[model samples]
Target: MASQSLAKIIANQQLNSKDYRLLISAPQIAKEAQVGQFLHLQCKEGIDPLLRRPFSIHDYDRQQGEVAILYRVLGKGTKQLLERRPGQEIDVLGPLGNGFDLTNTADKVVLVAGGIGVAPLVPLAKELIELDKEVAFLLGAANELELLCMGELEQLPLQLKVATIDGSLGHQGYVTELLEELLADSYGQVFACGPEAMLAAVQEITLKAGVEAQLSLEKRMGCGTGACLSCVCKVKVQQGSGFEYQRVCSEGPVFRADEVIFDE
Candidate 1:
């Protein structure tokens, strides 16, 4: 279920020049949200930026009735969001979109994240750890500066690996290259959230290795409830040979890696 409310901003802090973390008070939303779910946020009261912006739920505290969002200052909408201060009430509709499936009994799992895509996977990692699963994280960024959330993630019990395109980080290449080496091990399941190009590469690698994978996609959205059809993506039909459009906002922000058909 989803709800609309004026969530009070409890805390807001800048992680860097481009990224921020926002905490809000929304008990109903916090209680219902799952890993990979998102919130559609109205940045301002007026029609200046008419459409609401979509943000992935980075973390939530059900007991405290709080939810956190990690975002980058990408454009007008996010810039407006950056200006928001604690104690302000902002319009938000959330616990929207399907989340990653954690029902697998696999003992070993791998989570791959790139850039800010690491946001949604935090909760997923926490859940995996709670389930007593052996988890590993493979993170990638263009450079060391873009490797957001490293401090927060290090607090977890999972194995961590980092890669940067510039040789300034752990591995001097794409994270997918590191994934290729990790795939040689017998991982039960693989989950990823990143740029489409990275997801496509992960899909290829997982497909070749015959390992199951789920990918959380990021897309532009309007009505988070699936009425607008603005967040549709090409998906391979479950029972047929052809492809059809699926709403990323409702049907998924998460989908099987093999079923997503990326544009070439």
Candidate 2:
């Protein structure tokens, strides 16, 4: 169990039109964070926005005692998070959920990100590199205007690819199109995050290619650590033919991609 707290915000900045980055000094939680794990942030003030907003742990500098959240303003809670200023205190609970698994001895690894889904992968990529894995990352956005945090990704030891729906950037179609091209080559495994539709497409491609995959699901969460059962996603059992629902906050925000049944 982790200590819950009203941590003081150390920094908040707009990253782009729909997204922002917040840095909070949650000392105890930061100490236990792993890649793909998330934080359930309680809005400052009241229960009108009662449920905590789940944000992926973008990065954690344990030595600095800070955790970062890169979030998109999709609704009221997120909007409030975006408006928060430095020094504001907000309640938080986590390092919740199972994160990406990075144990493969595979020489080549592919990571795909779509829109704000890129948040959780940043730290995962860093960890892959530390293990000396060859990492290739593919990122997609609606257009150049909505793109976020390319600079930080580019700084990593990753062979990066970018795509825009309007052709303003790397590829002119969905990121999956680029992924299809990469599949013709030899790669160890694939990891991805994005809209459910996009994740579904990645699921389809990886399944056909016979490539192993892991997916991070995005869902609305309430209790954030399984008690509420609010963030349930249907996933296949790792060993069985039947399916079951797993709490995204606990069994995963991350899961073996093959184990998830993406259709609603």
Candidate 3:
């Protein structure tokens, strides 16, 4: 049901020296996007970069026909994207991939984010709040300067906590340290988007806590679609100890924590 389109840029803001946010007009994508879905944004015109970069759905307004992506400038592709200005059009394909399932989830939810991975969890928090659930957000980064979306995140009604490796702000540690405290207080469900090491830590911790956790994984992608195996991750077999590869782009950017088999 999804198709490629040239989305008109409504606004583009440099959140920091490294991060950027773009609000584009894509009615179909905005209407269909869910909490953890993503957009495949073309970096620049033609095939200069050769492939579209994947950005998680940061925010959207169906009524306004708007969608936003929060991204970090990591390389050639995103570097070119920074040159784009408002009123320009960008090629995009989206509302792609499965998102978190909120079915019969706990009333107390915790969201864990590491660095730029926090993008998708912002929308999930909004959805959880709208469902009348209590949400506690834990964000971790290298330092306060690296934190993205803190202003928007703080505006939400849910509880917010922060951690940094350098102690530049908030708690002087990883967000997982924060996650443990909230979970100990009877918080039941967890949704996390972060780096592999942090996600592995989360998986280990939540497993011991005996609470359910879902992880939104990040992998390099050549195609945001499953046609290429560029973004595959190993997931444990439902009936056995063996694991199978699944595409992060199509099958998930989200998966149950226990179902994943982390690399040693």
lDDT of 1 by residue, 184-263 (tens): 88887999999899999999999999999999998888788888898999999889799999999989999999999999
Which portions of model 1 miss their true places by more than 4 Å?
46-49
Q: In candidate 2, how many Å is residue 50 off?
A: 1.5
lDDT for model 2 comes to: 0.86
* Per-residue accuracy of model 3 over 1-264 as CA lDDT, tens digit each: 557899999888998889998899999888888989888888897754365899999999999999999999999888988989999999998888899999999999999999999999999999999999999999999998999888888999999999999999999988899988888899999999988999999998899999999999988887787887989999999896888999999999999999998889
Superposition error at 200 for model 1 (Å): 0.6
| Candidate 2 structure quality by residue, lDDT tens digits, 4-64 | 7878899899877777889999888788999998898986555544747888999899998
Clashing pairs in 1: none
Superposition error at 37 for model 1 (Å): 0.4
Question: Candidate 1 lDDT (Cα, whole model)?
Answer: 0.90
